[model samples]
Target: MTLPTPSTEIRPDLVLLAGRVRTGLGSAADAAETDGTGRETLPFDAVAVRGRHIVAVARRADVDGWNTSAAEIIDLGESTITAGFVDAHVHPLSGAESRHNALMLHDCETTTEVAERIAAFAAERGPEEWIRGFGLSFDMFVGHEITNEPFARAFGGRPGYLLLFDGHSIIASPRALERAGIDGTRDFGNNSSIEVYADGTPTGYLIESDAESLVTDLYPRMPVEARVTAVQNKLAEFAASGYTSLHQMNMEEGDLDVLRALEESGELPVRVRVSPLWRASDPWAETLRRMIALQGVSGRRWHVEGVKFMLDGSIDNGSAWLFEADTHGGGLEPYWTPSAQFTHAIHALAESGVPTATHAIGDKAVEFVLDAVQSLPSHAANTRHRIEHVETIPDALVPRFAELGVTASMQPIHAFAQRADGCDMWTTLLGRDSERAANGWRIADLDRSGAIVALGSDWPVEEFDGRKIFAANVTRHRHGSDRPAVDPHQALSPERTLRALTRNGWASIGHPGEGVVAPGARADLAVFADDPLSTDPDRFAESRVLLTVVDGQVAHRDSSLA
Candidate 1:
């Protein structure tokens, strides 16, 4: 639990004192509340940062003796400081670009409201220009009312592409489909489909990337300059939320270029590790080769570190690769053409010293990925290959995660956002009996088995908020409702959850010591309104972020902190 000493004492760039700081010095404790009862805990009262690295983290008296009056001093006044959060899996660039021109519909509650909002947004677009919008929730189309008629009436026959909030499903206007040359007769394999009427006319609802790309590919994309500004705006949002680093998943070639430019210009507010996507249309070897080349393209603030593949679609759309279900005709489908392609790609990439992060939601998908990881050569055992969104881990496979050293990169907010009354789109598809065993996040179980677990918001799929993550992991309950906990047994202790967001997330992306606050570590810290360790776990949501510091520089400071 102790950090090594620095070679020499030197003046720091900044000093922070008068706070209860969680230095993130040790492995996660069994439970958050009863941690370090008998063990000697490290003292964390103040911290000193030199350049972009921490120089001292000890009691105030200890840190003060080494530093003179040259550094900028900040008195935290009983605030709490912890390692800045690391969101392991996020898609921020696209979502940030969407905010510039796309019609934001995440706030709408009812179908009528959504239609009304779409109508108003469509009224502003030209007849020929594509009307693009995003953030349409899954529940909005529960009755399958997101057909072409409302879209046609609203857009006045203009081509339009409205992406659902989850990025899995899309409902396009008839004109948009016609413009994209998409007819109902087009078949997109087993996992992906274009919903059509009995007479073979299209319903405008497309599932999975293959089907949705038909119209989205035709939509005019944001220009490079506009995209850069949007990304900058998004970085400000992340810094304000106390995030110091991000594991950017599902990045495109253009997105990579934009990130490089940002890093070169010193505009990046947080450190980024990007995972360029391996599209299904491309050959496995070709994609792996391109992704491997990108591993060398890295800067201090951003880098291409891994490859991302979607093994299956979201569960809400009945596209997830699940086991033989008693109902829903066995919900199982693989996004890759040849199922072996994933294993082959994972091996080739791992052999090149590049890790793979696959999106696997269902139990079968999870198991298949674990098998692929297990099949890797013994030399690649420490590759740290990850299974993104281990949403459902079969009881038998839970222990295998530790044995194989596969990181369970999960999104806890997903459980709170999707589930209601212990039932959600995922559970509704898999009957009640199967839901209990299958809709399991099983994060606590994964930790207990000695497996590494990292948590993230899976942003754009869910809002990015570190406070909500803490609350969600502790309760697994809805924010403002009396709905029962989604899965009480899956709830992790606050200490464990914090480790997942900080140390575990950083290590998963190949930076183990980065998220810890110690000598020779990056100086990224988050200051909260209350001491998280002393505060009640249930009241975590109420604690506000008072300030955020990255690279020993202040990124965000609430006026109240002054």
Candidate 2:
């Protein structure tokens, strides 16, 4: 597995010396170059970078044979090079806010631990500053209700707002409730409720959309300049984790303006595919005009590719819009607006020649999205509609995605993190017999049934770590545990997992040659400290990104390089 040595006469624009390279291959022509050994054989010891493109990748032997003048060379030193990680569904703004505003609860094992952490965080901040935190789990608090009493006591008079890890529930203190102007009477749809005691006092616990909306309204968003700085910091974090590009899900027009400003000022370091949130109240003509006007806005740095639509709520909050109530007799309700409203919104987006990516979590919600897709005229295929978070799709509707040419954009880490809760929710909503068919991240099964699977991490909602995500996909288990592993037969191979995170993400958004390392492709690549393909899941999880190059520009590197 030795790379060809660099010849004294062979010079390249840039050279990346690595132990291995994993070229993202989506077709047989790309597949033929690698033997069944799952490794790439290159003739050069380095990759030559010219301006913002990779001019040549050659071994030392061929470097003298090709033009190498005016090139920059990087030595990887026994590491591996692969296509940069591309996250498809992320809330960059929220993720940035989480870096500062909220108490991070990503790995707490119990509710008491969560309370203690919030209490500690509140104690350190000034009295007037809002105490906001994220990543609380509903399942963790199942038996013990999330009352504001504990949070209020912990806050010691400071206002506290704790967002459930799913981002669908919120536990607010009495002060926060008063600040948001929400009383016990607010209706949040389904079992969605603003929890108050029998005394009619606000309980500080809000479920589903009501709770999420309250926190959103109460938290003073950062100014555009601050947001730009936060996003820039987030980009560095992403690059350090081996990502060179990301598709921002649910972006608003104002957010796009901020991104444009950053790009114009040469502050944006990563490529972005922006999907604006779509509302029914917007005039179709005006929306289309604005979308068309945004074409070529950032000279390939930013793209407005589609519209994001919410079809239903999350599974964790018991608002997933199931076909039936929970068998546990808790009166579980579906978390969607009226069916008529959803149908109208989907039709409008489809007819406007703009692609739509609907967030649907429950089987019933998936059905609603599918029905809407089926209702579209045959010409609607031109829009390339996608169903995001198809977490609990019915077995019967699985093939329909392929038949309709829809992309199943899913997050594999969600399955690993939420599997127990999701199964419990499904079993409660549908009977145990029905639970047998509930599927999560059935990658091979979905692809076999004719679906195009793309990967994403709903960042800030949950921590986005690409290595952990990829390891979860292949190992089907969290690190150091064999318990709760997914069906091994349905797990994806390491190579396929890489493709889903890279090329499939690009293809999902209508960008073709962006994720591969071949000639003529955008020079978006990540260099790792070890060969990811040969490493075990634990080793893969530990693999550090040594360098990130986007459009042939060095965006991130180990601190040692500085």
Candidate 3:
């Protein structure tokens, strides 16, 4: 397909030539007209950017149509260029600090390894300060009992916390739990729990959001200056990986202030749209007022215009609010008590013109969120409320996503992390037989139902690598796991996956018309070493990001590109 020529000559700030630009073809039906390849092939080979907006997209030799001499021209040599990726869901400050400074336990496979890593971390810190780290997977203690005894010994009485890879669980040192004054006596309601032994003693493992907060709230956070630097570094890392925008989920007031400082200082490297977390316990009216006040803060590259709420917990941790109990007998735990409180929160957010992105994973939680949105007054139809991580849903509820204008914000890497193989934690949690697949992310099913799908890596929960997400979306398997494809039929095409990763990501974050490379659109482009549109999943790891442009400025460029 081709675009019409501009009526007058244009002067651009930058001109990229000889590139295979994957201009996002509109929707599923538009892609249907293609040769079943799941994308429309645009004929453009060059893009002209003029001060944060694309001025023209046309053939490589058509540079004369614009003021070529005024623009900084770069010959891409037939490289692949797409709209810079927009990660729809991320925890910027927490994930950034963890990635750079946290004592990593990502390589550990057993409790012994976890203990050794913690011990080493404590030794380096001299047992005086709190030890914070992440990246312990579920398989580490699949059949074995979970114990913090070794963790306590390693910490040598100093406080320490080791968060599971899922972020829904945490293992605390015994001293930390003691300092928190959390005996096995207090009830954490249904949504959160402090794991206890047979005789009613705390086990040091805290599950779900509330339980994890017990230890986390006491652990001193990084100073504001340090956190700001960490987030800045993380943004640089993201730009280097080709991300131009990030939808920061669950930002606290402090975090928002830090981000604002960065933006004001002209240090932010990418566009950030944030949703201040909505705490249910706060009075609804006050909560709305606070969010409204926060929403007023906006900048050229940073904005706060949405609210985030959690409805349920992770499925693998048995906190998912499923309609049916799993084979091991666990199901249905809403974060908000009485469930109506949760519904009320969503309705209020929508009515107030603030879009909401909820964390709901189970079929029941998904259905409940949809029902809440459905009950909104007719005029609230444009709410664009989203359901984050629609991991499990019945066939009947899939179409309602489009019918009600709810975006399905999903993480493709999650399905890859938890394959349908009998060995994964999800399979064991659900006890999936041959008739059922436990690792159903339903991307294809949702697409077939005409739903808008936005993709992201939950970040600290998983490695937030765009190529890994691409590899997972196309292969339906983990990056290095030897397991077979979970359900290969659910695998998406490269074009569709790219759209979800880029354009759909913007839509999910309440920013529309910003994900494509076209006239009047934001000049956010990602340059790759090869044509990912035609590449296989196996070769995705070989494709490198050569450059990333945000708002007509070079945010990240490989040294070789110079």
Candidate 4:
């Protein structure tokens, strides 16, 4: 039992966000008040801010008596204040750059629609400009070969490519292949491939990053000003969705410059902690040295914190490093040609005191990452690591996550791809009867096993809406859909899901208390129109985000709301 305490020394700041407060996850619910029916109710109703931290948290009546002569107080009535959300896994830099001026195709239901949209988009661009499209769904090519034939005519001899929802594959137009001189089969020495037919004719389907880079690398670079603005706009959307910090998963070229520029002019909408990517093709020593050099590099609201490694690609693209063959005998190869090299890099990063976030989607990929963790020397315990997209793993592996202290960073929004009958690309890849098929996601399993489970949107891969993710976590169903849940038993409680989106996000980064709303905690807060815990799951997904405060400053405020 505890009560609100206002600091006698700390004064009010530029703006005081006064409102109904939920201090933290069921924290200090003992404001010591009850209603006429004897049911307990929230006792606190205001949070005072001073500079970059909360100065005090008290009842609305008591807060009004504090020294507020210099503060601009914005009263938020009935708006529930909670810890701001943290998207533990995101690719903001690349997502923004790839989406800049690209054709949005995530909604096209059929191949014909995709082609028509591509054709229309291409007609507007100059003949010399390469065309780009993003988030093309796999359902469009369910029954057909993943070749560019159906869409080749749309390019009209222009070099163009459309990225799949998996972000691990791309269907390049015929002219794009010709422009890139991709005319024959080429072994990437791993799972990545040029993807050709028996006749050695390029099918214009590139798998994994290595192969996709052949054509995508030829894309014209956007100017620094344009890149800055694009990322700025993208991050604002994140803040508007109730996010106050992002654990960015990749650091590509020109990212640092854009971040610096955004911060130099003014505050960024959200705090960004970038984890630079380490590719399989990089030279071992040089790459490690360069990554270590960026350990503490930071600007106002952004910093380089960890290194991300892709142990395997997505199951949809037949690139996941599974324990055995998928339904089509694909999804059996690791992204790293010599798998031991990945272990070596992880060991080296641990020795250098830099944490790693490995993308492991299939059962085998998850196991291999755990094995690598087991082999780490005892001294490495000081360094924390996480496995992103623990999409599938056996029941036995569930307990191992907590035993090994690996945070299970997951994107619940990914479950939107699941279908009740199990014909979705992910489920189909793993046979309906396969034991591993029953192990997908398993976020609740990890949490129950005492593993720290962090939630995220994966941004461009899924919309960065925190509300939608919250609904997805509890309902195990697409918001507003009447379809039966994909794996209903694995759904987490609303209380647990809230922690995954808030405190666990900071815990995954070795910082726990920063996500809570306390006097000493960083002043990052989110105000929702409806109390998430009490609202219906479907309605909560569409709840209005009344305000978002980062560093004691309002990042987003719905003008319509008081």
Candidate 5:
């Protein structure tokens, strides 16, 4: 099972991971092999790393063949060594900011409960301090109006702003609206809107990026030092959870400066590939030129290489571009005023050798993105394209991903937002029992269709725990919820789940050689307390990440190992 090595004469700094190893070979046939005995004889027990690259994958008995004079070797008893998980979609700078500055309301089940948490959070802060909150689920307002009425008394007239869990919308208190001078609705030139009542009284519900930005743009920025530390701490959490690289789907205003700050101190924890968003209202030609110029923009451990387009927003917030309007009479419009502009932007990015990752959550948005990619010239075929959040589509759209060579970057963990009885915001909007609701998060369907199905946490929306993401894919169960699994038929097997999290993540980015334990690959590996391919879903989800190695250096190690 040992791979051929150069020779013992070649001595290099080594990080030998000892345990069961998933060596990037196709998992099913390569899971086990034997020499006329019951013992597994497939992957070598250890993979040796030298200077940010794996030097050799060999058995433990061959240690004396090389001089082991100064090598940091970790002996993980029975842990599983595999390619470190890659998050295909994330929002680093913004997620870090929310984790540090805002009160979290994700766990609150009812509006009253949310109000209590907000009131408690605001009570502890000075009146001058802005009342901020994130992860407010839309389901709490299902039967009630989505206005500031429920939480108004709690904010106590402070400049309060709350971000919806979907990230496409916000709920602004009266004082907050006044602080931003948003007295009435104005033209955003797209689907973005400020919700108002019969007499043009602002209802404090802001939908889509343009409308949400009106209030968010006025919020105070964190100090540079604070931002850097916040980001660093969050990436550390990612590494500890077994993530080695993240494709940050959207870039924020000061992302470059914050990333530079981390790079200056050599504190950037994991590799991040950032893609700046192409806002709908931005001048098309000018923005496309700027985005093309931003490709390959790099720091020590991060780069800007792709553009993110929002063909539409989230279904939960009723901003998704659906074929049929939701029960609320929303979801028929694309984020872009005319969907054709999105297609033009896609074509422009592709022709310039720039890859694109479009945020398309609904059926129409996904179809439009696929149509745009299909319409590209043959010369543009070499450029990579990814469709993020393919939440739901009819049967016909499933196989188009493979045919078009588009990477399907999905977050199976997002099923947590749904209830068993189809009462969650997303399900209820699409007619609780509709076929579209039943088709949400088709991880298995796309994977079976031969698409490069890359999985991600979509952190800040979902928590960045890799185990939860992995388990959610297979178990089909919502995190910590007693409800039945969402569309159990769409669940992925454990083997398929690992590949989607690892190999396909790199393949989606058009890098075929990475995300493996082969000798010449990058030295990014994860050591899990349980085999990531374990059949016991509950145990796997709760398993600890004993150690994580990045660039031949230990990014995380469990205290238990020490």
Candidate 6:
């Protein structure tokens, strides 16, 4: 059962066969090569890996001429091999937990479908057991609303909680709210709301942080063994999908311990970048200190390199703090902590040499982060801070991100899913003057403007499908729908999109030279059944991962590989 150890010599002990390799070396200037074209020079054959690094890449015929005594050759057949995916933003623990429990709402195209799935799950569960589910999209549902009526009927007596796709909203059954001691009328004073019925009774729906916290509290009480099993199952599924690394947003210290235990037991299968949740009452400095102390302790298997700060609420729920009042007319509130508090935290993290990635979903929120970053004293300038979900940005401020060294960590799938509603939201919230300035997945624009755009799936909120996400960036169209596309001019080329998912993603997290198959690079690569570069746009949705290699080790392979 022992796995073979990769050789440590300069000469490779393994050879990879790729049908037509897209090395992702698009332009000579953008790439690290001395060649002027910046285009990827290809051998069109095999890549050699020795130990955890790529040793050489050359033609299939030429590789045999180098050395082969200790080599293990893997023929990729017609598959195109490139760097393994580095998910820029993900909640691996949450995604894994969702994968193991309740109904998945990612595929529910309509409200009726969501209700049906919940009802089915409820029918099978015992009365006292809590019914938990996630990935619901309210915009797609009728009336742009999620009610607990259908859910209450299905699990009328049982406590039930269903989380929105964005993890910012939840529809709780009457029983669940009563169990949480929330009658739907109490406002948490943070814009998080509990929907109430006309009769002054709780409707069983909670919005934003307040709603998500209810589930967070319940998870710890679940059997420790069951939680561990759920995490393992989630990791297995992610590996099967070809993800080699993930940045789990909204994680906490307790969650970090579980990951450490998993690694200690040798049960962890993917590299994790954890960002612990930040709270007003929490000791931010002490948390960072503990995380720093644990650095390299897991031998790079698990590390908390960055801190996550929630600067704004979800845009879908009308809670996203905007620069101006939304046209739809709900009173706007700033979502970030006071500037002084955020600035102090940012400076402390910077001084500690830890990076910060704040969630900013609205123009105002993005502005707040940018302003706070700009105000940082000289000592904090090099923190390489990031603003997550810059869903809407004013044109004048776009270039400032690169100038300030802020990574525009974006989720392309959101653009596709939110196009109809998002466009209207932008126009209404930003006004006619700023409407044309609305930037939605403006990757090409941002790149040209000197900003670094890194792509992420934001999984569970969105499905973690690299190919589909890439397609979404290029086409601005959902998988099967014919709808009003977002700004097509902003679409990125396949090479650019690939880099965002690979090289750019690594760079965003301060890990460079990853996501490529060059010498001195980690031997993490993904092999697909078709040339992603030349494949039809529609076909990208159906593309299957033929092989996935992480650190020169075979991680996932099609059943036929055996």
| lDDT string, candidate 3, 189-234, tens digits | 5578888899989988888777888888887777888888888888
Q: Over 4 Å off in model 6, which ranges? A: 1-10, 27-42, 107-113, 140-147, 187-189, 197-201, 219-222, 264-268, 281-300, 419-438, 482-484
Worst 10 residues of 4 by lDDT: 1-10
Per-candidate clashes come to 0, 25, 0, 0, 0, 3
- Model 2: how large is the Cα RMSD against the reference? 4.3
Q: Give the residue spans of candidate 2 off by over 4 A.
A: 1-12, 26-58, 144-146, 187-193, 197-200, 252-254, 264-267, 279-296, 328-336, 418-437, 480-484, 560-562
In model 3, the runs with Cα more than 4 Å from the true position are: 26-42, 419-421, 434-439, 510-512
- Candidate 6, residues 310-342, lDDT tens digits: the string is 877766666777776665554277544454677
- Please give the RMSD of candidate 5 to the true structure: 1.7
Q: Model 1 — which ten-residue stretch has the worst lDDT?
A: 27-36
Deviation in angstroms for 16 in model 4? 4.7
lDDT, each prediction = 0.77, 0.70, 0.79, 0.86, 0.85, 0.71
Q: What are the RMSDs of all candidates, in order?
A: 3.5, 4.3, 3.5, 2.0, 1.7, 5.1
Cand. 6 Cα-lDDT: 0.71
Relative to the true structure, candidate 1 reaches a TM of: 0.91
- Report the alpha-carbon TM-score of model 5 versus the true structure: 0.97
Point out the higher-scoring one by lDDT: 5 or 6: 5
Which of the two, 3 or 4, has more TM-score? 4
What digit string (tens of lDDT, one per residue) describes model 4 on residues 269-355?
Answer: 999999999999999999999999999999978999889999999988888988889878898789987999999999999998999
Which residue window of length 10 is worst by lDDT in model 6?
A: 1-10
**Candidate 2 vs candidate 5, TM-score winner:** 5
lDDT of 2 by residue, 176-268 (tens): 888778776566444467777888877787876645567557677778888778887887787788888887876643676677667777845
- Best candidate, TM-score: 5
Better of 4 and 6 by TM-score: 4
